[model samples]
Target: MSVVHLHLPGFSFGDVPVLGPLTLTVDRGETLALTGPSGIGKSTLLRIVAGVYPARGTREIAGRMAFVFQEPTLLRWRTAQRNVEIAAKVSPDTALAALTEVGLGACADRFPDQLSLGQQRRLALARAFACDPDLMLLDEPFVSLDAAAAEEMMGLFADLRARRNMAGILVTHDAAEARRLATRTLTLSGRPATVTADVHAAA
Candidate 1:
C-alpha cells in the first residue's frame, strides 16, 4: 500500500528559491530516482519528504524509514558493526547481516577512520538497511567509487530490495544508477521543487 506522498507548496528563502512545488509519492516496494544537476535541490526534496524540510505541505508516510546522507556520517568512535547496531530498533544479528550483505562484514570491527571512503559509505548503507525500513531514503548513495565498484554496489542494492520488497527513494545524478535501481524516475522544478518528469517501468 502507498501511504506516503510529499506535497510541496513551493519554497523560497529571502531571495533564493530552492525547490519549486514538488509533489511526489513513494509507492510500496518501488524505487523513485530523483535526478537533477548540481544544486537543483534533489537532496533537499528528499529531506522534505523525510520530514526534515521546514517548508510547506504535509508528508504522508507510515512505518519506520531511514535516510542516508550524501556523506557517510557514521560515528567515528564506534566500530562499523557497533555503528550499525546503534539504533535500538536494529538487532545486533541483523546489523551484522546487513553489513555482510553489503560486503562489509570483515570491516565490521574496523573504525570509521580505518575504512576507506567506499567502505565507510557501505557501512552507512548497511546501517540503514539494518533498520529493515519500509521506506528507505537515499541521497547520492554512490558518490565516490570507480565505475565497476559503483555498478557492483548498485547490483547489490537491487538484489537486496528485490529479496526484501523494500521501497527506496533515491536522489542521484547518474542515469545508470537510476535505470538500474529505480522503478520510476522524476525531475524536479522550482524552489520547493515540483515534479517535472515522471517515468515508471514495469516489474
Candidate 2:
C-alpha cells in the first residue's frame, strides 16, 4: 500500500495562491524528490504533506512522520545527545547509536554551538533517524554543506532508509542530489505550482 496519497487541487495564503493540483503516491521505501526553483512552493508542498500547512486536499498518510529542515534546527543550549533525545523522544542509548550512525559518536556530548555546520547537520540527521519515522519530510536536507560532506550525508541517509524501509518526499534544487537519492522525481512549476514532470527510476 502507498505510504502517502495526495491529491490537492490547490492552496492559498489569504488571497495569494501558494500551491496545488499536486497529485502523487509514495510507496513504502520510496523516496520522491520535489524539485523546483526558489520560491516555487516546493517547501510549501512538503509542509502540506507533513501536516503543518492547511490546504485543500485529500491526504492519506499511513504512518508516523518526521521532518528535516534545510537548516539543522538543533537546540542551541542542548548537547548533541540531548537534542536527539528531546526531538526523537528516544532513549539515550538510541540517541547515541544514531549519532554513531551519522559519524558523530565522538561529539555526542558536545553542544550544538560547538559543532561545525556540517557536524550540526549530521546531528540533525541522527535525531531524525532516531525518531524511527515511517515517513520523512526533507526540505533541502543537504543544503549549505560542502560537496564532500553533502555526498557523505546523502549516503548515510540512503543507508538509513534502506535499514528502516521508510518513505520520503525530499525538496531540493540540486538535480544530482535528487537523482542520487530519490526513486522518482517530481518537478513543480508556475505561480501556484503543479507537478510538471514525473519520472521514475527502474529498480
Candidate 3:
C-alpha cells in the first residue's frame, strides 16, 4: 500500500527559515491538503517529500510518485504529448490518452508556448497521470484559471485519483478548494511553519 511519513525538524532554506517541525502521515487513497500564508514553505514541504531537499528528520515514501508544480514546467520546445511522453517515460499513445483524460487531447500537438495557461496546467496534470504514480504531489495545480475551468480540473483530479487509488498532498491557499478535494486539511502557522489545525471532511 502507498504510504508516507515525515518527521522533519525545524529547517532553513539558504538564509530563510522554512518549517519548524512537522509530523504527518498519509496512507493509501488519502489526499492531505496543506495550506498557509504565501511563502510559508508550502512548496518547500512538497520538495522535501519529493526528496529534492534534505531534511533533519526521518522521511519515508513507499511508492512511485509524480509531482505537479505551480508552474506547468513543460518543455517549451516540445509538443504537449511529447513532453508527457518524455517526462512520464510512457508510450506516445499512453501519453496522448492521459492528455485526453485532462481535456487536452485536441491540443496534443501544441507546444507549451502555444497553449493557454489553463491548457498548460492540464498538460502538467496529464504528465503526472501518465506516470501512473501511487502518490501525487500537487502545488497550486489550479492557479490562474476561471472558476469553471478550475472546477473542471478539480473534477479531473478526483477522477484520476479514483482510477489510480493515488494518495496525494495538495498545497493550496483556497480553503474551500481544500475542503472540497482533500480527505483532510492542514493549516500551517508561524515563521517556521508547523501544522496548527487539521480538519477532516465530513463522511
Clashes of each: 15, 1, 0
lDDT of 1 by residue, 1-203 (tens): 78468777776667788877656777788889998777888887788778886777877888879888888887899888899999525777888898999898888789999998878878887888788888999999788888877877788777778877677899999887888889999987654556778989666
TM-score of 2: 0.96
**Per-residue lDDT of model 2, residues 57-166, tens digit only:** 69999988889999889899999999999999999999999999989999988999999998998898899889899899999988888899899889988988889888
- lDDT for model 1: 0.82
Full-model lDDT for every candidate:
0.82, 0.91, 0.90
Better of 1 and 2 by lDDT: 2
- Rank ordering of all candidates by lDDT, starting from the highest: 2, 3, 1
Pick the TM-score winner. 2
In candidate 3, which residue pairs clash? none
Task: Give lDDT: candidate 3, residue 190.
Answer: 91
Which of the two, 2 or 3, has more TM-score? 2
Best by lDDT: 2
lDDT of 3 by residue, 27-68 (tens): 889999999899888889889999988888999998789999
Model 2 collision count: 1
Query: How many Å off is the CA of 115 in candidate 2?
Result: 0.5
Candidate 2 regions exceeding 4 Å error are none
